[model samples]
Target: MTVTNTGATPARIRLAYTLPAGLSDAGTGGCAPAGGGEHRCGEWASAPGARFSTLLRVRVDGDAWKRMPLSGSVRVTATAPGAPGVVSDDEGFAVLFPPGPPVPGIRLAADAVSFDISGGSSGLEVRLGNTGRVDAEGRVEVALPAGVTVPTPPSGCTTVSPARTRCALGTLAAGRTARLRLPVTATPEAQRQAPLAGAVLGQLDPRSGPTRQVQMSFRITSAAALATPVASPPAPTGSQGVLAAEAPAVSDGGGGGSVRRTAILLIVISTLLVVFALALATTSLRRRMTAPVAGPSAAPTE
Candidate 1:
């Protein structure tokens, strides 16, 4: 509420007002509860066009559901010194009971994610969500089980321990969601099903806020475990055995197989090319050998 001094001369003033139900003065500007729900304030000095402002903190008292859709008028009258018996002014007011906004409730989205520990993983991804009416400020912390490691933490995050990571989220507004991928790696013997634990902590001691606890768990798998074994072909005998023994063995689980496959392919192609060239030479020599006395016939014709 604002009160403007529109009079020509600066003078002290007094105010008398009665608050309707659900409306309460916050005891600001020296306004005190006179008696019942009425309040009295001032003898305040003011200049022309100077304004005074105060806040009316409101709340729903008693049964607001049924009492809602109802309104009441409030009359605040101000009088200057020596202006007795003269009605200064009058206006009507409506009482409102708007429900308070919900507190910021930031929580993590603990979705189950699969990660490949056999050199197929860039990192683990963490998702977040908020369920509340206000914005929230907090940090997200992720901890991994042993054998799994964070090669590089996600943006806005840092590693507190070998297995733990924390990412600070300054303000997570309600209804806003986010996802961040944390760079990770694992050894061959790393723990499977990398358990990712997260918690959202509030900023203050419940008055402000931190993140609400939201645990995110990860499931990690290794390529060796997931890969199906391939049966090796029977060993060749005689001449083929010599070549087979010189070539590297094949494995279904590791990347070395890819390299071995290319090398074997090149060897086969080269052998085929050499055999084709030798066959052409042999055919030409056989034709020459089968040909009869061409040199004698040419000499006779000349």
Candidate 2:
């Protein structure tokens, strides 16, 4: 079947095909990598299996034909020479398509990454989620806090630091979901002030590539808390013991000083009251003597 793109704007197009009955070429084009006799696209023209392969030379309005890898359903998009947009399908088939023009670079929203820190000294585990999309290839890196250490990433992962590591996800397809757990060792002091640093999960793909890439920043927080003591402080000895023994006497002296201050205040108040009463009595006696002298003079005149 002949497939053509009549759309003015270039786009990724997909096509599906079924093989005829009773032919078994195994989809081999009679050309393969060295020491490999696997089936190629041309041989599938007569395959009698549930699926079949088709080779179509796609020539854009102004581009040449290019070879792209396809697994199940072939995905072809407007691309440049050498690197063509190729996608796989669920069924078995070899796909051939035309080369696409050099596409303007596309950008993706960096994947949003977060970390969940788990486990302890024996080892630490870093869990990742919310990764956006990386169009190209390079590395998926996670930088851990200072004290927290991660074990080597399982198999496909690489260690970038004693505490940081990465996993190879190759070309992360658009909208793909990836999860990785990194194990590390908690440093001796990690428990006190667990260092919280930012993490970067990115695609190593270069600045200039047909594929686009996105990056995400994850804010990491330390999970350590102060540990409770299993025992209490021990008692002091010798000279220290002597100082402890004098604590009661110091308290008793403070009580006695407070009592003495209260007594002094009471005594001062009593003395002031007594002086005031004496002055009042003296004033009354003078008034009485003066009144009698006046009475004696008044009586003589009468």
Candidate 3:
């Protein structure tokens, strides 16, 4: 502020000014009295037609700048000794806050993964990167679908619940990336496509706020679908080996036919023996009947 005396005679003058609330003098560039909220310059003798100026440095409160208007007034009182004090009109000024640093940006390198059911223990590497100018500190959380389990979690990660894992990322500098390896085991129930959702909690700001979600999907398939089929071995070609292979089957058929023939022959022989015995008995009976009367008369004469 500059004070000029345009009168013909030298004069004594004082200037008093008050800054707005939430603003204060930054440095002692100008002479002012102490203990008062307002800055006061004591009476000074100014040469006729001479000008005087002093710097008024000020600083704004950080919290107040964000919530309140940036405009304020500075009241100044000027006077010449022995004359009525003159109150100048209020001087208005505008405050401009400096721009804040850029926020952190999140990106996922891949958006989907597929695993074979017979692949045993499979893994997916998720790349998390920051694209802004500030460091990011937050917790990364992942939610896996049913029938899939985290066999080996990434570093600094812990199992929060069934199929849910949380990893603490301490600080990621600008343009840096962190690779998280999530080893998973798939079951038959994990056939169809399943959702795999992940998020970084406190990326841009330290306080809790909205987060960016990285959504992905996964599916399980048969190992045959992923690999080529193996061919069967060719059969043996030599006649000797072929006959040896058929020998047991041929023997089984022949043995069963031989047993059937033996049973039939034995039944025929037993029927013939009974018929021959009956014929011999019939002949002896007939001869005994014819000679029975003569034998009895001879026995009586003796």
Candidate 4:
């Protein structure tokens, strides 16, 4: 910043500067961090027509390398005495750093995915993050578990097979994330159980510790598991069994009911009479056998 006191007398001059994110105080040109990336550069008394310059230095943070949305701005505001009231101007300047490093680190996050069977499609979401300091050409290949299918793929995505899918991401900026959603279909079998899944970084250096292939359990929820259940009827009570053991009877209005009862009574009486007659004949045969003394001679008397 250059300041010239063009007024007749000496004037008090001061400047306020702001540094955007991804930048920090570099400590130069008699500048110090006032607070929150802002600096107070002057409180100088300059003579008439005296010209001087103020330099503000800043350094790019290591974390900002290759990260996206890095359009940072530096705001410069100057205040001095002028003919027309107090003179003040606020200006913004764009600062660009050389292209960030080319290394990209990928970390993946997953959510439980689900869809309807009859509808034949559901929303699929996968979150991918750039952990390195460079922008990356992002892409991912997906192979669905048994019984689920990827039928229709969107633009920039291809259905390599009934079970496999691939999607292209032009460039994923560092420290940023890409959210992917693809439509999918599930078979009846997918609703029965949850499946195991994981991801392995395939680029320059495979993240060993935290970024290593993450193995996680995921399930494709289906419609069958979500169906409502039906209720059952109640059991019969004791009063219902009072006449359940008897033969069911047919009833006619008036005279018919009376006639049926009479016929049942007569049949019971006849059965009893026949049983009594058989008992009397058995008693007579037993007595004749016990008293058979002069059986042959007595036949003459007969």
Q: Highest TM-score among the candidates is held by which one?
A: 1
Q: What would the TM-score be for candidate 2 when compared with the true structure?
A: 0.31
| Cα lDDT tens digits for candidate 4, 1-302 | 56555444455666677665777778766566788767766467777567877666778787643232222222322233432223332333334333223333656655656555364544677666677776666666665655566677878888787766777755777777777777766655454332212121212122232322222223345544434221111211121010011111344757477888889999999999988998888898889989858755444563
Please report the candidate that would top lDDT against the real structure: 4
TM-score of each: 0.36, 0.31, 0.34, 0.35
lDDT of 2 at 119: 30
RMSD of each: 34.8, 33.9, 46.0, 37.1
Ranking by TM-score: 1, 4, 3, 2
lDDT of 1 by residue, 155-193 (tens): 688889887778876666767766767766765534221
* lDDT of model 2 at position 151: 56
lDDT against true structure, model 4: 0.51
* Candidate 2, RMSD to the unseen true structure: 33.9
> What ranking emerges by lDDT with the best candidate at the front?
4, 1, 3, 2
- Candidate 2 Cα outliers beyond 4 Å, as residue runs: 1-135, 204-224, 229-232, 235-302
- For 104-214, candidate 2 gives per-residue lDDT tens digits of 232212222222334343332332222334444545666555555555568787777675676776554544444455555555444333223334434435334443333
Clashing residue pairs found in predicted model 1: 200-211, 201-210, 201-211, 202-209, 202-210, 202-211, 203-209, 203-210
Model 3: residue 22 alpha-carbon error in angstroms: 51
Per-candidate clashes, comma-separated = 8, 25, 0, 0
Q: For model 3, which pairs clash?
A: none
Give the better candidate number (2 or 4) by lDDT: 4
